[model samples]
Every structure is written in C-alpha cells, then in structure tokens.
Target: MGKRDVDDDDDDDGGKRRKASGGFSDHAPPDDGQSAEIQLDQMLAGGAGLAGLGMGMPGMGMPGMGMPGMGMPTPGLSVPGASAAPELDPLKPATTPMDFSKLGANMPSQEFPVPRDMVEYLMTPEHRQILLEETGCDVDWAPDESKVQLKGSAEQIRKAQRLLQRVLMHCNWGRSEAKVRRLLKPKIIESAVLRLSPMNTLPAGQKTLSQTQPVISIGKDKKANDIVIPAAIVSRQHCVLELDIDRGAIYVIDCSTNGTFLNGLRLPPKTTGKVLVSHGDELLLQDPANDQEFGYVVNIQELNVREQTKLQAPRRLLSTEESATMGRDFQ
Candidate 1:
C-alpha cells in the first residue's frame, strides 16, 4: 500500500507541472521563439540580441555605420550632404562692362546739315504744301534744329531729297541778280503789283504782293516799310497793301499822318477798317491841300486764270491746279 501511495503523489505533481507549461505556451508570441520580456531583458543586458540594431555591422549605413567627424563613418559608403555641392566662392567675378570703344567716333552721320534759311523756308506752310505736292512727303525740322526730318517711304524720301536739292541749288542765289527766277515759278492764288510814279518826276515803281508777301508797307522809313519812297511828303508808315487769299481781294490801309486819298475819298488813319481796292483804283498818300498825279495804281493779276477775282464781293477761293509755265521773274 505504501508503494502505491508514493506513485500516485508523483503522478499528481507531474500533471501540475504540465498544466503550468501549457498556460505559459498559450500566452507566448508566435513571432519570437523566446518570450518578449526575456528578449527585452537580454537586450538590456547587452546579450547577442542587441545585434538587431546592426551596430558596427558591415554594408549597413547610418545605424550600423559610424557618424562622420564623430569617430564613426558608414562602412564602404559615403556620408550624405558632405562635399556634395560644388564650391560657391567663384574663381572669377561675373561682370560685363560696356565696350564703348566699339561705338566708333569716326562713323558718318545719317543726318545732313541743313542751312537755317532752308530750314525756315521748308518749315513754312506754303513751302510745305509745295513739298507735299511734289514729293508726297511730310517734312519737319528736327528738335535739334536745322535738320530735315522727312516722314515717308524710301521712294518718297528720295523724291523729297531731289526737290530739296533743287531748292537748295537756288536758295543760295536768292540775293544774287540771277535770271534763274523762272526755274520754279510756283502758281499764285492771287497776287498784285502796285504801280506808282514816285513823285510824277520818275517812271512807275512797282511791288509784287502774294500770299508769301501779303503785306507791303510803303513809306519813307527804310526800316519799317518794304517800299521806302524817301519822299518829303510821305510819313514813316504811309500805307499798307494787303492781299486777301481767302477773299481773292486786296485792301489798302492808310497809316500815314498825311491824308491818304483812295479814289478821292480820304481814309480814316489807324482805323480798324480797310478799303477794297481793284486793278484800276488809285492811292494818293498826300494831303488833299496839294494836288498830285504821283500816286499808286493797283494791278491785280489772277495767275490762276480760272478763278475770276471779284472786286465787289468777298469770294471763297480754292487752290488752283499747278500749271507748268516758264518765264523770267524776280523774287
């Protein structure tokens, strides 16, 4: 009986041991052959399990390799961000300077020097109209002055240049007593020549009046009047002869201290009015106290023969078509 009891006690103890082992195995993680707590304890104790971090391991970067300049470097692999970028301190300065020497000081200018007289002549509306008609180009003086600024096509510019050359060829001879006056006899809308016997002792003296020369002051004052009669009876600014292009009529205004007689009618001096004059009218710039045949006779000519000039009424005028005619004349 004693032998039997001892054998039963040993059987119970073995069963209890097997049951505890079964409970432990049921709660264990399948991934790790060891329990997590045991492995954590072994890692903390620096056992072989610490090798999982790959410290000092070959071909492993960062974690396995050592840090640069910290007594640690990656095994057979370079550290990133170190010596990757090129040196930014440039070997030479990046700068460019203007080479003004390339701008040759000896280059010829495209602009031609225009005389001041020619510039003034070309700038006038009358001459500009002529230029437009002849060359179909618009021209102006440069702000720099005395430079012709022509605006047009190349062909038109050439034509303008030719016309300018012709004018320049004669402009120099304007004052000289040359017979080249008939070279370019521009058509006049309405113009007149004043004929007068200076003092009944001399032949008839004449003065041409056109749009360009619309007003002519006749008196003894050489500086004030265009036609200086130098007569003892005449005043400084005795009378003015004005041509009306729009009206195609001419007027005579008396500015003389001595009475001026127009067809025997005395005109009010310095008045704001003008007297209409015709081809046959007469002007006596002397006091009525003395009778004199020495006076002016108006001779108005319509070079534009088509537009008949009416002395009685103001008539609207138009530019007549340019007629090519040649004759010797004076400026």
Candidate 2:
C-alpha cells in the first residue's frame, strides 16, 4: 500500500480503539471496585426500596426496587398477572352450601350439653323459631339445664346444637374464669354485620353469621360461593369472611383478580394472609376507582358496655415526645 493509505489506516485504528474505551479510564482499581460494590450492597441490604439510589441509573425505577410509593408494588408482594380468572366448571354445584348436601337433607337425632344458664336463649322466640324451622329440632333442655335432647333428625340436631353453642361461646360459658362466667349473663349478643348497600343490580340488605355459620365465601360464580354478588368485576371466588365469635372479630381474605378493598386498603389478591376487620370498616368488592362494586359496611356490636364506655371516654392529648414515640411505634 502507498504511504498515505497506510497512514490513514493507522489513524482510523487508533480512533476506533479510543472510542471503544469511551475516552475514560477503562478499568477501576481493585479497592475502588470493592468499595463501590459494598456501597451497592448496603443500598440493597433491605431488599425493599433502593434508598439513596438516584433515578438517573437505568432500570432504577422498577417496581418494588426503586423508591417506594412511586407506582411500585410493595416488597414481597406478588404482583398480579394480567390474566383472566379460570372458567367455572359446569358440573360444580350451583351454590356453595349445596355442595355439602343434596336437596332436603335431614340427619338423625342427637344430644348435646347445653348449659342451663343459657336456656333462656332457647326459649326466645327468634331462636326457637330458627331451631324448629331450620333444624326441625324441638330442643328439650334438661330440667337442671346441664344438657339438651334435641328431638330431630341428625342434621337437625347438629344445627340446633351449633346454634346453642354459639350463644354459650358468646356468653363466655367456657372461655371465662369461673367467677367471671357466673357473673356474666346472656344479655347482649356480641355481633357484627356486613350491610350490603343497594347499587346497580344488588339489593339493599345485611348478612349476619350466626346459628353455626362461621365462614362464608363471596363471588359471582353461583357454584363456589355462599354469597353470590353478580357483578361483572367480581371474580368467581372473590373473597372470604371468617367470623370468630369468641374473639368478637372478623377476618377478611381477598382472592379476586380485580381486587377486594377493606377500609380503602386493597388487600393482596390470592393472599393467604387475612386482614382483621372491625366495625365501620368498608369492604368494596371491586377496584376502588370503579363505581359498580358493592360496599359492605361493617357494623360490629360493641362487645362490652364497659369497653364501649372506655372507647368513648375522653383523653388528654399526649406530649410532643410521647406523640413522636407513638408515631414511631406505629411505623
């Protein structure tokens, strides 16, 4: 090649090499590299939010990795996939309760211990009506009130027994100390309700779990849930309510594709974890941004008159230090 052509070729190669290195230091010192990694490890130590990491870095804005509350999913939360719910199987039962029994089910007769102290409850018109009509049991309480003999089919007897047990449990018959038990009376029924407000096609009403009904499933599919809310946004098995009578509490679990909201908080869909619910907490069966969902207003009957009074009792404001400490504790 001519001298000029060779000179041009060498100049081009030099420029290419310089550009490949980006005109900066091509290698970091071993110590400097280690220090940079340590700093990065510290930043990711919590594995929650990438604190102190500027957004200028590529991919730093990823959900659950970048700064929290920036459209980021919470750490450890399973971001729901953009997929449709599974189709309902045509062979499944039409209603949740029907899955357990066929039409017109009746069990053999049975006996159970129904405390005499709560016998007055059985005689109450409302309870009596339920026992006779629902369970088909005429519960004959022992004269001493130690036990009961329910004259009905087995299913009927079980139903009656469960009803009475709930009452006993509510009254703290076995849950309380002997002295407290004797002092307690069946005066107040510690209860709560999910009052479904009328909207779209849903009717106005309330659902109270009693007479042995502890858990009820909600959804649009008739075969899988006891409480069927026919909303286009509702999933086949939307959510579940677990009522704990002894503790006077209710737990809610969301298992929907759209969402289930409790007190304006969207519960993690399909999560096994349940949120403790109290009175006045609102549960929405659809995305809060949507207006077609039903809102169930929780109405928890006060557990105790003394506790109620204490809740309503006034209190002086805390000092600044105490307030700060309380805030930190909640955080």
Candidate 3:
C-alpha cells in the first residue's frame, strides 16, 4: 500500500521509466521464483511490525476489508503466500474420488439452530440506537435489519454503512442490560472496534473525485462536450457511476426513465448495467418520459496522469517500453 520513492531512469530509446527501490530490486528479473520468497519475507516482516504497532496484518481480521465470517478472509493474512508451505498440484488424477458428504453426515447436530435469535437481538431497537449514537446517524430508531437492502453503487453502499453504524451504536446503548452486556463482551467488542476503525482508503497521494472535476473529451477533441442531467430525474432515480481503477474505464448507470447514451449510441436502461466511457467521450442521458437530456464529458489529461501513476513498476522493469506500450494499446 506504500509507494516506493524511486528516480525515473531514462532509457537509451529516449523513454522515461521508474526503477523499483525500497529494497525491492532483489526480486528483479532472473529470480522469478525467488521473488515470491522475497515477497513472502517482506510480508511477514511487515505483518509482524504492524502487529507490534497494534495494527493487525492486512488480512488479520482488520477493518476496511470486511468483518470476519462476513465472507472475505482477513486482508493480507489469508493470502497463499502466508502459509509456510506452498500448495502442490497432483501429478496425476486421483485413484479414487474423495467423498466429503459422508465426512459431515456424522457430525453432531446442534440442539438449536445457529443463534438466529441472537443475531436478531443484536439488531434490536435499543442496540441500533446505541450504534447510531456512536456512528452519527440522526434517527428515532435503529435501522430495520430485515428491511435493510443494499442498492446502487459502491459509494451508496458506503453511505449505507455509515448510516447502519450509527443505528447499530444506538441499538447497543438502549438494549436490555443482559443483551447489551452479552453483545459487548470483551472479545466481541474488540473485534467490532477493530473492524470499524478508519483506514487510508485511497492510495497515498492520489486525488479523490471530489478534489477535481475530471474533464473528459472524445478522441482528438480539444473542446469537450458538457454532461447534463435534469434535476428532476436525478432527484427521483438512482444514478450510479463506476470507475475501473485498473482499466481507467468509467461506467454510468441509468436507473431512471431516461436512457443513457454515449455519442449517439443508446445505452441500456436498467438498475444495474455497464457502459464504457473513455476520456473526452460525450455522455448523454435521455428520458422519454420526462423529455430530458443530460450530457457529460471526460478529461483526458487527468486520465493520462492516473494511467501513468498506475503503471506497475515490476512489470515495467521486466519488460521493454515497446512491450508495455503494446500491452496497453491492446487493452
């Protein structure tokens, strides 16, 4: 997550490139397999240091990834490299297929189903009120978990999480003493606290969308077209925008009566669908129901800066500029 500060070395071909520093050159070419070992060591050292600082390793049940058992493994801890031994592939097909179903069949059944009641209790009005107070949500009652549904873009999900956290805090405070005490047991509280702690969400030195308005224009166009949307439609329906960090791609979702269009092509109208928008490209959203049109354009220079900064140094070191140029061109 930390960027290496290295000098950009000029190539014989008059191209500019950066070298990988911060003691990472040991993993340079001719050591493809060895690089993994070096990286593993680095990760272990980093993880241990972080642990000493009271910061869990990337995957070690840390927040900003996801809560444990919520699906994803802790960020950096569960990676394949963390294991002492590397996994090996079988040389030939197994002589007999393994049966996993029978292994679980004899497992003892629980007297009661996994604690659905406890989960419900955690989301009760009193608990939610406590969470809300902690998370800064102004609400009369905790959110209804049963009715809570995540929708729209990733940004929307984040907003929802903020709201939910507040509700959770509020609920926590107002719950019955027994229930509150049970949910806030030391281990549970610690786990929750660690999971909710703030982190550096964006890459260091990177500018956020709010910091600047990225001007987008079509190919070879100096003057970009204006992106417009009627206030009525924006207010009534969800508008989601997705930016693909790796591809430098942008997608706009039209969840309104008006359909989204790029150039002259009509984009699909759905709550969830993707439309590619490149730098300087014109985006138009038309709503037949309301007779409205919205237009938007991209900024190419900013996109180029982003693309340049995103280029992986390891890949650049291992290959020539021509090769890298070809890869990007094709992509």
Candidate 4:
C-alpha cells in the first residue's frame, strides 16, 4: 500500500486518530504508547487528563510536573497550608497567690541574729594587730573605735581595705565582717563562707615529737591507739581529710588502699567518702587492726597554724562606713 494509505489503515485498526490542529480528538484515544505521550503533553499544558494517570492536576511552568498538593501525600512531613500545633507553656505556675495569715502565724520567721559572743570570739587581739599593720595604723591602735577612719582618700580607703582583706584571708578570717570591711568596703556571702576550718594536732607519741606529724584524732577516747581510715587506700595515698571543725562533719578519702572501714563496715577504700566523725564516733582500721574513737573535745581555742592566721585577719563589711562618716563629719 502507499505510505499515507498504510498510515490511515493502521490508525483505523489501532482505534487512534490524529488531532485536528492544536485540539485533542473528540473520540476516546486508544490505550497506546503514542496516546499516552499525547495525554502527558496535554496535562503539562494545563489540560484535565492527569487524573487518568493517577496524578492530580499538573502545576504550571515545567512540563509534566506535579507539586506537593497535586494528589500524592508527602513521605514524612505535614501537608502545606496546615495549621501549626500549639505548644504548652512550661513556666506557668500551678497556683495563684492566696491569703495564708493563719499558716504564716504557725511558721517561724527565718531571720537569725549574728551572735555577739561568736563575733567577739572571731575578732581577737592577734586579728586586730594584723588589721592595724595592713591599714598602716599605729601599732597601739584599738579596733573598738566608733569609726576607724583611714588616712588617705576614698580610693586609698578602698585600696587599704582590699589589702586588709588579703591580710585577713592570710590570717584565715575572710568570713568575719569586721575583717572583710577593713579589707574590702562591701562584704559578700562568698567571703562569709570562705573561712577555713582550724587545724588541730593530736598528742605526740613518746618516740619523738619531730618524727611524728601532728595528727588530729576523732572519737571520744584521746588515748585510743587504733585508728580507722574510712576509704580504701592504695600503696602510696595522697588524700585529704576536710572537716568542719565546728560542726564535726568529716570527709575522708582513700588515695589507694584495698579499702577503708567505719565500725567494721567495708567502705570502698580508694574513693572519697563523707562520714560524721562526731563525739564518740568509733574509727577502726581494718588491715592493721587499729581503732580510735572520735570527738574527744570541740576545742575552739585549739587553733592550728592555718586557723590562727585566719583568726588574725581583719573582718569584712558589707558596706563602707566612710560615706556615712563623711556625711556626719561635714554636717
């Protein structure tokens, strides 16, 4: 057959027909490769044939392309144009303020006055001497003046106070208000808690005082020979025993030993541990079979070399008395 005639016969058998100009054929096209290509092209041109290919309407611009909302759901993300979920406020309070006058009357006030005896005890003669030297005051100057003024200007006072504070810290009285004020004009809570615990020494053995390092024995019996190291210790241990001498709370560590024990309890030997070595607390050494009693006496006067230094330092104050004094002096 001729080319044109042969093409016409093929179209008739396949149920296909060419488009008239730019428009689609009115009759349904046969399900063939060429028909599919024509349908895709029509969809890309913003036609309505994409629904037959299981796709929604094609978006404009690129050919045969579909956007997010063009029928298929996104793999893991929420749909576009969706409302955002509300978040809960974590900082909102559960209850509102209410009258608690009856409850308030039952609760005691928390205010505590600084004890006069405690204050006096902290400010000793040695401490006064140290402050005088630091402030460049007369050797015989007394700390009991109504207002002890510095010789120089305000800057000088501040400098002197800072120096005095350093001296007080050296003496180990950084916590004392009088000492802190003499050193730094404004005292702080941190300074108040900076006082170091006094060092103490146990009585030396008969062998030789020089050979025996001063040891502080905790427990009731001062003469108890046996002592317990609560934490485990190894061959060479370098550990410290920090204790609040006033409150009798002790923290011990075993640098390296198989272990330390307290009252026959097997404590982890090489780790840091805290135990209340109060009056009558028993300390027993496990390996050596030595034992010692804790808390012989809470001697506040038995100041160690380090504690003595702290006590001899000037007290710190929260504010400078200079301004008040200046106002009074000029007025």
| lDDT per residue as tens, model 3, 48-76 | 43343233434343343243532234444
Cα lDDT of model 2 by residue, 43-95, tens digit? 45745233344433444454443434544543443334524445688999666
lDDT of 1 by residue, 116-211 (tens): 755545455665565566666666657357877676666667666665554555344231212112122233247666565444553355667677
What C-alpha lDDT does candidate 3 achieve relative to the native structure? 0.36
Q: Report the Cα lDDT for residue 148, model 4.
A: 34
**Reference-based TM-score, model 4:** 0.20
Top-TM-score candidate index? 1
User: Which model, 2 or 4, shows the larger lDDT?
Assistant: 2
Q: How far does residue 326 in candidate 4 sit from its true spot (Å)?
A: 44
Q: What is the lDDT of candidate 4?
A: 0.33
When superposed on Cα atoms, how far off is each prediction in RMSD?
A: 23.1, 33.6, 38.2, 24.9
What local lDDT score does residue 300 receive in model 1, on the 0 to 100 scale? 62
TM-score of each: 0.34, 0.32, 0.22, 0.20
